[model samples]
Target: MSRIVSLTASVFAIGLFAGSAVAAGDTITIGIPVGLSGANSVVAPSVVQASELAVDEINAKGGILGKKVVLEVADDASGAAGAQKAYDLLIFKKKVDAIVAMETSAARNAGLPIVNRGKIPYIYTSFYEGRSCNPYMYINAWVPEQQVAPIVDYFNKQGAKTFFLIGSDYAFGRGMLAFTKEYIEKNGGKVVGDEYAPMDATDWTAVLAKVKAVNPDAIITSTAGGAPNVTLTKQLRAAGIKALYGNLAVDEGTARSMGADAEGIYIAGSYFTNIDTPANKSFLAAVEKKFGNDLKTPNELSVPQYEAILAYKAAVEKAGTTEAAKVVPALAEVSVEGPRGTIAMSKQRHAPLTMYLGQVKADGSVSIISSFKDVDPGEQCPKLK
Candidate 1:
């Protein structure tokens, strides 16, 4: 673990060179408004840390456009108002060259309108529902349609005829449930029950009892962070109700937090500790070296943030400029080898190319259940024209 954290720290140092070098007296700043506090803090710190690592690596490689990149971070505290304030500082006050991210969709949605109005290119790092197509924003994570589609298909193959849908009562959870419900019903499955819990809610006994009563073949949970997921799984096992469990938002980070309770639980995801690729091997080794075997990275979100910084660097080099107009197209067309495999970007969809799907096993390890396939931006996106 010390080695992994040190590696990330080294990368963060190198990434400082990613912004365009100030022309003698100029400064190139990158605004990052991430969840540094509040309910999502468990996931937020990693995103910020990973982004710093990406910046450090870029700076070490000589930076974008021969200019040094300076990363300026602000705590969104995982709320709408806080995120909006962070963007105001990054754009109007700090005047950064580009913005890297806002971790949650709610925060992004709260701040994106301001970013678009200013025409500052921003990269979003979390997987979200796909109804957005913004010229000024780039999405590096999977969409609901993309991530949830295959999970439903897998359940069908497993003979899961009835499912219970539970999620955080928010846009991301609700949107995921909507798309999943459509897909599952279309495939001849029934949603026996659907429930929503507040994002910060800790007690899930009521929801668990509701699930137990329904006794569906599977449960599709779309909550955020680690607490609810860990609590629910532990209590369910304590109650001895062990139906097949799958999660959309639960990742390795979440799994590790659950300890022995996370054993045997399955999570559909894009990457894991056990991936065999050369880059992934190096990544895992570095992480193990830094955080130790004790800190489990359950989700694939961190490495993607690392790749986005790299992808943005590559785009800046190809375009020969960091202007949004130049860099936007570069970002859309750029592809890079990532821990999860190849990530490609589309002009129409700000999010990068999607590939491969896997499931988290007991003992907090991940196994690939499906190979990479290009996921097209679904028709649900509002027209930009």
Candidate 2:
């Protein structure tokens, strides 16, 4: 199997590919596989921009290990096949030293085998289902425990006893809801309604009607990404159910896009554009300076991409090499100060971050209402061998 894999990689390297001639040690290439076009496109720009910001900062500081950092971007098209193809290109053709990815679980799962085969250090920068254990993979985003538990606790404390749950019919959505149900029940709350919609679902009339009928004390939604999230929020507001809406998938950028519809919605995550820390303020100012009037509001979903790149830089510098074997162990000890705070990678290859709970104000900006400091990922991934 190893011989066959090597032959295939050799063939790909010699084939007609744009970046196939890229030599190792010349530059530290970080591949970014994201939904540049498709259902997830709404948030993709922010992901790319944040990553670029990190690269610029690192390069300006004399690069990492005296080698300039560069990005090799590939469009995942919001699908599993696209992700697999993008990963193959990055690993076999472009020969990127590391990968910073933001995609759905299906896409990530599809690309995992390729990552394992190539032994490249892959940083998954997206809020996802718990327990994604892989030898060559690291997660820099919130897992279920870091994201759901705090929100559930906050809702329960606020007298939200009966909750309605809705999400896209996918691994991430279903898995998140499962954790949410457990947290709600553990907190002495009941799930009044549990439902799901397709990834591209646009109309929420039926779901809204059912939600009104259930009349839950709070509505917890994880509708996939982009248009689906916006559609669900808009329809919920149109229905005027008046129940507290707790959104696990809505980020600051998406909330701003929702405008008046986003008002009063609840969200919990590691970063928000309006977070009042000096580090956060400096990060936001840097973004504004780089992108100027074209800057999009940074969100929890996108900021992790920036943090992931920085984490990789720190690990590589500490390890004194970009080889996956050396960097993988160094990653466990690497710490980077992000907009959220000082985040360090755990032994399980996930970051422990500070979580914040906020409500979208009338102007579509988040108002921090509660904060959970230094929340550990407590990941279920098996220890790397």
Indicate the TM-score of model 1.
0.87
**lDDT of each prediction vs. the true structure?**
0.70, 0.83
Write down the worst ten-residue block by lDDT for model 2: 1-10
RMSD of 2: 7.4
User: Per-residue lDDT of 1-385 in model 2, one digit per residue for the tens?
Assistant: 0001011222222212323454666678888888876667778777877888898899899889988788887888877889989999989987889888989887899899999888999889898887888988888888888888767877787889999999999888899999999888877999988989888789888888889998999999987767688999998988888988899988888788887999998889888887888998999889888766567678887888998999999999999999999998888888888887887768478877788889999987899988888788884676664
Candidate 2 stretches with Cα past 4 Å from truth are 1-24
Candidate 1 lDDT over 9-103, as tens digits, reads 44333334444455733445677787766556666546656666666566677767766667877777676888889888888977777887736
